[model samples]
Target: MRRNWAARLRHVTIDGLRAVVLENERLRVTVVPGKGGDVVEFLHKPTDTDFVWLSPQGLRDPRDHLQGAADDVAQFIDHYEGGWQEIFPSGGAPSEYRGARLAQHGEVSGLPWEYDVVVDSEQEVAVRLRVRTRRLPYRLEKTFRLRSGTAALEIEGRATNDADLPLHAMWGQHIVYGAPFLRPGARIRLPEGVQVIPHETAINPPARRVRAGGPWRWPLVPADGGGQSDLSVVQEPGSPSDIVYLTGFDEGWYEILTDVGMRVEWDATLLPYLWMWQELGASTGYPWWGRAYTVGLEPFSSMPTDGLAAAVANGTALVLEPHETKVLRLRAEVLA
Candidate 1:
């Protein structure tokens, strides 16, 4: 027998920013329009816990969103309010491709997105958010839907190129998880036969664990201390920050079981590659200052986070013909 649960959708303002709140028996999601239509809050009703990480800098008003930083990375960190963001056309550091300079994390994550309520009912709620890139001749649209009595979210997106020239791009979902729900003893499960590759640059401390540019099997990783650390289990806060990429997945899915048994499952078919970003309070830089202890399980269309130019050079970038459109489907489900 199925239980009837109260489901509703409402529009509200958070800190002077337009937001849409969708709630049901199992989940509550807050979508902010001004902040690149990012999902700032994803709360599981059963445990009253939020899976999304809120940056220490916190959310800022669109008016205060900074621009003209010395570089794109600086610009991105200045306005980033950790949660779930869509990176389009490029990822990683700023680079030039086809006469256009791409910024770190891309333009869509920082641009204002137009949203519309597609459906609002007692059984289900859906919304569509769309944005057009100012520097590129492309338009992106994403539709987020949630149904009653389920702890799952369905995301469908489409990217269309309007120009006559082909476009080389990288698309990724920056889904970050923070404390309380993400703690030590948490385990990650992925498809069989997956290979983990470490980043080339030694930007943070954890990079010292695996041989740079070397490929290792998933979960059991050789640490720099001459021992192995189960990469599947989450470490305590204040650990070193590391970045790695996962490939050779037999299937497109990964699951994370928290310390308390809360499970998060992600579909990887749409995105394919998983980028693991570990920021366990190791970043002592200007933005983090060693205060953030979060992990990003990002699914990307390409390898290497060195921006679009690198992706293209490595022949891993996705190319779209003139007037061509690509559609991607992703789902996130929680089990308590």
Candidate 2:
């Protein structure tokens, strides 16, 4: 029994899978190594709020999950439980890149990862998680660290190309917010001069608010109902499901302000785009069935979620030379 208090680390199991818990005075984070190293729980101790959303389907181990249907998207959606997922290689939809079949969000996010505790102390605790893509010739390693007396979680990652040839891929941090911290009247804050690009087509039809087609300024867009809709303010349930991309970042930081707030910062050079996905219960379509009420603030290296091939066609995909490595840094802090 290792009992200290300022910062601590523990290993446990969830649904017969390996899990790691890292905590301090202000936050508790639960990571399931077996499930794509997903950060399922990000709890703010002071507010008793969990910032990450939990989907209706909940977490299901892919190994034991029997696929009723065969489809490129079902592999990911069926097991998705609305936590933070690190999207790599391919994002959005399935695509074939250089003859290799890439599934939705790539192969790494659905596979198990190996973990090792690097630092264990009262002042700080850190663990490193690593995974290699089954199809792509790449390896990803990330370290999660928590310090005593701080409400911030720091993540440092590296993606390396293990093959002898150059590779093109898309990388993203899919972080979503919901429930206690994500209610009506909540506000989203971004740096000045940031612009929002609405999805090409309207989603959730009749309920959709922001008119399609906009390189609009932050927070406000021409509404479909003849007035301007405030994108900054979270609307009531049943609001349209919207997808927008934020660009022209003076810095790589965004804040969600409510009774309990959260600030997320990342390396802007590595991830130049931020994807805002709002599935606020208006999606009565396939998958959601109007059961979702969440917003995803994702920092991505590519745009529009059409998959890697589209990103390559648009010239937004990141290219890694043979044996090259890319480093990533990100942080999430609590604000009340």
Candidate 3:
């Protein structure tokens, strides 16, 4: 138990940022000092279980690791790794170069992401995070600005092609939300897309649209929320592990409304594509058969590599010249 957990656990406070805990029934985030105060845990706890911490834990070994679920966030993108850009050219395979050498998502996001917080004239706290890699010529900067009444994330940087030859890549924001925020009665809101694969296998190549039913809707998982179900939660309630995608984001934004009315609106002008990830009991470690416990609302720059490759082959990958710099902006606000 915390010494004064009640008053202390309201909004996130920076007590030298040693080990601060912030709780709000549905969302509880703790910032711990690790590899430079960059490790934080965003947990969704209900009355049913404890120690069911989430957001993402750390790595077991840098060389060897597992796939998706909670592990996905850590291994794929650590807050510690690179700066300006998240680079993993040859996938998660180990390499020989230092700054250029990295795994899956990149080096910056895979490790503790260090940042400098600016407490400004109005008392708002802002953190600037950067991921850069030598082998890959580009940088990803995600700025998170938080005040008492508002929280905003701004990304306006460059993923420049440093290689003499053009480089292909995809940028994404994988917002993994945990329980009480995700429950049996909770629902996932999105535009419209019929097919989606389990988060476990999404990182792998299927070269297809995944197994699903219907044209506008499908079952999120099988009937019992166990085993595999091409289940679609377009409008109905969804399991914790339900996954969905939206293609009609020509509007470029969507809202994830919970049962209790806690709405998480995603603005994706810069990231037009959104990938919905719902994994119920699946995060319980291995053999994700019937476990439904969490969800991932991922906003990505491009489709899967296969899709991007298809675009290139068919002539549609986003192309930028040396002086061309495109700025992408997305905003999400929790209404009062």
Candidate 4:
């Protein structure tokens, strides 16, 4: 008996933008090089499940789309067709660095990247993507690989500060999950001794259950109406939009299980903090209009979503001395 080609790499244009597809026997992963090198689609083929959440507005090419307003934050959110964005240099709100302003989640997520199909074999396939930030003196490179017979996608990345002066930046992986894969009964699993800290304020006040407090122990947090809300269990649709931080991880790994499951593991030292963003139909205004339901499991080198300036102020930002480079690795595996 002979085996067919188990791993392959292909390219296609998605919504007027170039995208690269890498797949094995179990998973099909799509990378959009023209839009921030985002992992727009991660499909578990056997189950026909896509774990990535796509914004209702869908992917829009910034080059072709006309802006309604001249806001920096809108520039990112208006085009935020949620998938998996590699946030760099700034992770949250717009902030100033050396008198230059960094856009919300800026310097990378909205910029186009250059990619090359570095490996194309029957047993494995890989692609390398590189990008240089427009407003910052930084260069980032990463390669994504998928191997035959494996359901895992491996990513190796390097971030370099190309300037002569020291640079501080907030780097993160903004991976989100939505409907079809995420639902009321879905469960989340994290490492032991993990602590959860709710954002001081709720993004959707009316729907939020967890009160703003804690370094609370794992899943159960003090609910607003005086009970404990379980963090491990996914809430029903129309629940609150909230933000929380998970810290004190002995290791960096998480599992989101529905009928199918996804397990993501990364270097804890490289990105020690995990931000859990729940926007399960609670945001009734602006971008979402209560139409989106998604959960973001983000790994970061910083805390809070207050941008690089805040990360630096709080001592959570990744600092690179002139010409220094930091390399990191992560893997996302699909489980049946």
Candidate 5:
């Protein structure tokens, strides 16, 4: 019931200096600029409402907003079914596969950025992609400011780490929405004393005490495969759990509930963990068969897989000595 990705895009192009091509209503949004400014792409066309995607293609996943080659980085665990993306490499840089040592999500999604085309707002269209990570000396600034309004996206960032590894990293803004734009009234709003963690349910493999409490309620307890941990979850618009959650948002500002409030707001104060991933078809453990509709608000400085060794064993995973500079700020708010 949304139906209007900026009046079907009509056509807008700079094509690629850094990239900027919005063509709504069948949706084809590409705003790329290294890790931080990465919305990469999202193509879905059901017959061109005016034009969403039919003139620019290279979508395997990651929204088909395809932003490859700065070095043409590719390695989603060795082809995550072709096109998952790669390029965030830096100092340690060395991963072609196998458990993955460094470059998991550090640097800037496979570095090689510095692109520009500006207008910022009021519909002149925008694109600003800057990157710096010469082996982690640290300096990242990404701005993919696009405007025509709601289908919605906004992100302005900064990160300065003057050399020193104590900078454990994990940040997420991987938004993937498809299947008639995830129809079914679409709902997923966070912050209200958040707490939701659902990854174990193959008859309970090992999820460990259900997120323990803070922002709890997703598959909170009770699942054979009926679905219920949080109440606003909807599937069938795409039938995959289209809304997604993994919350605890406050200073990180998060809210999205499609179907006329037309929303999307994510502001990361150094990312405090937010992941609302959804899956369908056998549900999910992702060994793969496939089902539609997607969601992943993933913003993290730590919180999964030893979370940087549990933030370095309870000291809060951030330590920079020998000539250091640490200043981080992230903001994104677009509402209608």
Candidate 6:
């Protein structure tokens, strides 16, 4: 008899919440099925370092989850224990479309998604998670896979408009990086010819050093004191929050160089824009209280974080025809 040493899948509980974990020789991943199907942990075996950031709020048990609050943003932030989330139908602030109102960060991020183990083999293990929006007539399905002897995870997603009318929406991936893995000297590399502009709706003006609404080249940005801050390098967290939109990618790829490097490669045609969110202990509101420090390198199907309506008005929203489906693929790998 021979022993098999490939990837394996198992069910586990974290902080009293049901979760699924996948492990191999090189990596270990944990996904919470009930909590928006978020990937709560991504650990590199060699270094024993987890790349994913865990929110200070910690994991909230599904039993304790509150629903249907008057303030959607407050409700969303209350349960946001940082990790990777899939934003669909809409993004950013609350917006009205058709006759329905979409919540902040959309409906899926805080909703429970149905998950099933699709493959349980020695060579690879995969899981599929699906969810349907309450306000939008769309079904979202995502498949996550991890192969044996590799330090990478692949994600495939499909969004289908299940209604008779066309739908205008914003789709994005909210990936935030945090401490230990995110520190000074770490560098972020993106495709050349990229352009960026300061977010117009930034709440705190004093927290960020970059001038708002200014278009400039990638990586190198003009600082407050007329100096230049290299956007590629990770700096100490203490500054205020800043948001920016990135476009004009020569290629659709970005990498964060640290002790455990991470590279995200995607289809440029489907998600052509990138949203950079820097929260460096600047938020002094209810959720953050100026205690959170993280960076979000999000790839979006549209521009601006105002709302779906603004995206539609700017002609950046993706319009899906009746019964149409769009697919996207991306890979997150540990760089050698």
TM-score on alpha carbons, each prediction: 0.88, 0.92, 0.58, 0.91, 0.30, 0.89
Tens-digit lDDT track for model 4 on 7-43?
9988899999999999888999999999999999999
Candidate 1, residues 1-336, lDDT tens digits: the string is 222456678788887778888788989999888888889998998898798889988877544625743466766777788998999989888988878888887788888889998987778889999999988899999998999998888888899999998988899989898866888767777666666776863122132223222233233232343434456777776665677887665456767766333333444554667898888875687878988988888889887888888888877788999999999887788868
- Against the true structure, candidate 4 has what lDDT? 0.84
lDDT string, candidate 3, 303-330, tens digits? 4423333323433235544434455554
Candidate 6 lDDT over residue span 1-336, tens digit each: 222467999888787776888888998989887877888888888888788777888987533636544476765677788889899888888888888888778788877888899988888899999999999899999999999999999999999999999999899998888876877667788765676665763222112333222323233232343344456666566554667877676567888878668988887788887888877775677678878778889999887887788888878899999999999998989876
Query: Considering lDDT, where higher is better, how would the candidates rank from best to worst?
Result: 2, 4, 6, 1, 5, 3
Candidate 3 structure lDDT: 0.41
State candidate 1's TM-score.
Answer: 0.88
Model 6 CA lDDT for position 246: 72
lDDT of model number 2 = 0.85
Stretches of candidate 4 off by over 4 Å are: 1-4, 65-69, 201-228
What TM-score number comes out for model 6?
0.89
lDDT of 2 by residue, 124-242 (tens): 99999999998889999989999999999999989999999999999999999989779998888877667667666312111222322222323323235434446777778877667
TM-score for candidate 2, please give it. 0.92
Over 4 Å off, model 2 = 67-69, 201-228
* lDDT score at residue 200, model 2, on the 0-100 scale: 68
Q: Name the better of 3 and 4 by TM-score.
A: 4
lDDT of each: 0.78, 0.85, 0.41, 0.84, 0.41, 0.79
Clash totals, every prediction: 0, 0, 49, 0, 18, 1
RMSD of each: 4.9, 4.5, 8.3, 4.7, 18.0, 4.7
For candidate 5, lDDT tens digit of each residue in 1-336? 222434322222333324445543334556544223445444434432111111112323332334342222232322222111222322112332123344444446544467665553335355556677654455655554444533444446555566544454333444434343344445655555555544442112233233221333444222344554443544442243433234455656555445432234555445554545554333444333444334445555444423233334434344545344444444333332
lDDT of 5 at 314: 38
Q: Quote model 4's TM-score.
A: 0.91
